[model samples]
Target: MGRQSPFLLQIGVFILFFILQAATMRDRIIGGREAKPHSRPYMASIQFKGKNICGGALVNRIWVMSAAHCFDNLRPESMQVVLGAHSVTAQEPSQQNFTVQASISHPNYNMETLENDIHLLKLNKAALVNDFVRKISLPKQGEDVTPRRKCIIAGWGDTTDFETHPKALMETNTEVVSRASCNSSWTGSISQHMVCATSPDNVKRGFCSGDSGAPLVCMNRAVGVVSFSSFRCANPRFPDVYTRVSEFISWMEDVMRSF
Candidate 1:
């Protein structure tokens, strides 16, 4: 069985409802620079009503990986996935849009702590594989992200809750923080199914509003899904948490096989 609904889950100081507001969502990379077009080919914009809602990773032609919390009160018909997109506001010829066919949130996902926070999105049709749009490789089962391993996160979430306008996709370099260190910041806030990442010294950068479900790529493999961060946005004191992909490989593969 699944956990209780978290549509009201307070996220990044923005009410969950506010983050899902319609109109359009833009690139919200805080303390990060604009990403070159297709530089991260597997990056995906999970849009709702043509507006960016969450970040996702194209794991295969027909599937995308994201945070389960993103689906709260969100219907598949109202959502679409944008591939090969650079600017959230501008549509490029390389961009391909697909209607979402289904959203499968993990049955055991916990709303309070965001455990098993991962989710899989099935597309109505297989994505077109090309230079600008491609699939990210998943980690082998039991694979682990070493502490302080450098990684990258990209997204089009809100720079601030009030900045609703879209901008070009932004990305930042971050590193895995030790579980013990991360736990110290949250104090029993993180679970075994999750991992944490933080920007380097004095950088004070991390995920923020509208960045949920973003991918945490390390060693050229998709290792985690952006789960949550400090409500204050990149507060260096609290590293952002992500759904550990390696821990859910069986669940992911099982879902794919069922499809």
Candidate 2:
């Protein structure tokens, strides 16, 4: 789950619904099953004061990608990234913890509209890659996920609305929703910078609170960053929205190179 920044400013009436929706988003993988231990090596548990607050993907040995909203009002010094984690609550031997040397949110990020919600965290030290810890591949610049494509979302979020977060990672399969359909459902608030997905069988199975900043893995590539969902979460009427990572490939490359 993620916290809404206090800097949320009014953009327009059309965007107001999204602004309010974002305020209540916590980010979880609803209706997902437990992931196999060490199966998602790239998954990163973003923590603050040793508490899991958000999820992320290890894109490189030194760089972790997440949602910009997750770091709002949070300091880098207090943040940590735990890689190779299957059970976030366990003191697993394979888990590698790293201090966040820096937290960089996209320059053009908008707290109100939830646009450009991508973020990156630089690790204090390079990760030691191994069988249970490795980086995931990134999408090509400007690459777009086609409608109806199936993708997997994994995180340490609750599987049900009332259930407490499980110790093991959870994941679910979702199908990409077309921009037009998603925009219609959201009243034209869906932007090109974002992507939408829903359960293939129309089940209420998608992201909810606590899964923010988690990667939407498609074709073995990290294609989207969990942004926000309806306040009701996993509601069929409102599909989950994500920051289209391909749209910010250039920005991410620049940040990694300059920093």
Task: Write down the lDDT of every candidate, Cα atoms only.
Answer: 0.83, 0.89
Candidate 1, superposed: residue stretches over 4 Å from native = 1-27, 161-166
Output the TM-score of candidate 1.
0.87
Candidate 2 C-alpha lDDT tens digits along 1-259: 8875555544455488766666545757888898988899999999988878899999999999999999889999999899989998889999999999989999989988899999999999999999899999998888999999999999987666554668799999999999999999889989999999999998889888449899999999999999988777788899899999999999999999998
- Candidate 2, run of 10 with poorest lDDT: 5-14
Q: Indicate the residue-level lDDT of 106 in model 2.
A: 96
CA deviation > 4 Å runs, candidate 2: 1-25
Question: Which one is best on TM-score?
Answer: 2
Q: What lDDT is obtained when candidate 1 is compared to the true structure? A: 0.83
lDDT of 1 by residue, 1-259 (tens): 9765565444544754554543333335567777887899998999876788889999999999999988878888889899999986886998999998889999999877788999999999999999999999999887878998999988887665455444788888889998889999999788778889988875856676337888899999989998877756677898888899999899999999897
